[model samples]
Structures are given as structure tokens and as C-alpha cells.
Target: MTTFGAILKAHHIDYKLTNRSSLDEWFYSILDIPIDELSIFDISRSIRQDVFLEYVLPRAEVFLYEDPLAGDYDGQLLYDISMLTEAQPPSIMAILKRISAYLSQLDKHNLDSQSIKSIEKISALVRN
Candidate 1:
């Protein structure tokens, strides 16, 4: 059977089965709120890039951010960054740029066919 962690990783998401305590600490510290104060659904609201720099990344040994398929039932992509420590800031800007570029392409579907082709090229570049 595929482990949950394996499934997450297969989709380019990061996870650590052994790091729940640290994850909780990083999450609480970043949002300036206790872990118990929020539900899992509330977690995404706290994942701003600035908050990541201030609280979690600096202390983390390693970290990753993923852009999973939209409407993915599993929260793996969004939650993966909490595994990082405060000392190990990941490339948040790079991740955000990639995500923004992807979203921009997705947003261009309302355009004409020629514009859609341009968007496709942009999306391909972002993937690379």
C-alpha cells in the first residue's frame, strides 16, 4: 500500500511523518496563534509568504512548497511548508512566482485562441 507521505510526494508535495510537533510549533509561531485555536481549514489563511519568512523557514532544515491540482481533496501541498525550520528559509519567492505564472495562464482561458496559445507557452515555461 502507498503511504500517505508517498502519495503526497508523488504529486510534488512535501511531508514529514515524524515532524508533527515541529510542524505545530512552526504553524503556531508564524500565525501568532495557538495550534488548537484553529481548524485544519484555517491553516491555509496563515501560509502567507511573509509569515513563512518570519516564523518557519528560518528554523527549518528543509522545506518545499507545491502547486497541486486545483480542488485537491488532500491538503498536502498547502501544508507541506510547515516542516521547515526557522534557520532554513526556503525559496518562497520562487515558489510564488511559479504559482502566479501558472495561475495567470489559467486565467487566460477567456482570451482568444492566439492568446490561449501564448498562455500555454507561458505555462510551459513555468513548468520548466
Candidate 2:
């Protein structure tokens, strides 16, 4: 298994030592500021698509599953993800297929309207 640090290293995203229990926490800790206030484009511009697929994409489910509005205050995983997808990286088809599956399994009834809208946008974007 690739250590979370290894993935961050692969992306050239630097971080200081910290006490974090999970990969999710470690992922957030590296960011200088909140992801919502940051531009996904800026953060991921230099990231290799293959590395994104191998490391980031596989973690999409864990990220989305932490929807803040749903009472999970983990962070804006979806926010960054949505923006990244909107950027239309070369492996977008694979991204769409992977994230679409995550979105599909969502209990839409439990999601707030805004969340639903966001998911719809992502889904629709992938289709086009």
C-alpha cells in the first residue's frame, strides 16, 4: 500500500510532520488553507494525470462520503473534486466513470438540494 506521504510526494505537494490518524486527515493537513478557498486548478495543474488516477481518483468515494452538509465536517472533498473534473483532464472518461459510480450510489433523498445540484452537474458534465 502506498503511504499517504508517498502519494503527496508523487504530486510534489509538500507537508510538515503532523499527528493525523487517517489518510483523509493527512490529505487535508498538507493544504496551506481550506480547499474551498483554494483553486483546484492551481493545486493540481502540475499533477500527472496517471498519478491522479492511481492515487487521488481511487479515494474519491472516501472524499465524497464526507459531505459536510450531511453532518460530516471532514472538509470539501467534493468541492475540489468537482472543480478538478470540470478542468477536464485527459483521463476524464475514467474520472467520470469512477466518480459517477460514487454519485450513483448516493442516497439522493438524503442530500441537500445544493448537493444534489452539484452531483447533477458533475454527472451531466461527464456525459457531455
Candidate 3:
């Protein structure tokens, strides 16, 4: 049987599945949508779409929309990496890591200098 964690991993989304009750609480807290509003299938579909549209697309777009003067940095770096040689590079893993870290910081509600540094680091990593 494919477990919830396996499904998440397959989609390159970083998640930890707890009991149904804890999952319900987390769904409510993060999405602000009640568990009752969604079936398990609905929740799974929503998570898949959310991972793609929210995290993956935006990160990919950032690389695409970089300044021309940047000298095709993202293109060159991608070309250099064998792992990203596909027509549409699989950046879901990187996107998930970034989104996970961002959400964790937001949950803490501590926007200190370290938080700013983290944002800058991620921006630099993606921009190049």
C-alpha cells in the first residue's frame, strides 16, 4: 500500500503524516480549511495541485524571468547539472525544501535578521 508519506515523497513535497486527528489540525491551521470540507481524495488532490502551482511554478518562473544581464546564469547552471537535463527540469524537490523552510519561519512569527538572511540566501540560490 502507498502510504501518505510515500505519496508526498513521490510528489517531492516535504510532509510528515501523523494520526488523522493531527493531520486534521494541521490542515485547519495551515490552510484554514476545515477537514470536514474535504475527503481524503480531495485533500490529496489539493496537496498535489498546491505543491505544483504554489511552490514549483513560481520557483521555475523566477529562473525564467531573470535579468538578461545576469548572463543566462540559471540556464548555464541548469545545463551544467546532469540531474536537470530534462526538457522540463524537475525542480519540485528544491521548491518543496524552500517552501517548507519559508512556512516554518512564518509559523514562528519571528522575522529577525536571520529570517532576512534566509530569504536572501534562497533568493540568491534560485536567482543564479
- Which regions of candidate 1 deviate over 4 angstroms? 1-40, 48-50, 53-90, 108-128
Top candidate on lDDT is 2
Models sorted by lDDT, best on top = 2, 3, 1
Instruction: For residues 59-104, write the lDDT of model 1, one tens digit per residue.
Output: 2212212222211233232233333223333464444344435446
What would the per-residue lDDT of candidate 2 be over residues 1-128, giving only the tens digit for each residue? 45545566677978665656564363455444333332333233212223244344544544455542321232244444454444556565676667766787877787667666666766776776
- Model 3 lDDT tens row, 1-128: 33334445677977544557854655434342333343333333334334323332333333323421111332232222212212233464466345335433443243445444444444444444
TM-score attained by model 2: 0.48
Candidate 2, position 114, lDDT: 66
Residue 111, model 1: Cα distance from true site in angstroms:
12
- Per-model CA lDDT versus the true structure: 0.37, 0.51, 0.37
Off by over 4 Å in 2: 3-54, 65-75, 85-87, 90-92
Winner by TM-score? 2
What C-alpha lDDT, on a 0 to 100 scale, does residue 46 get in candidate 3?
36
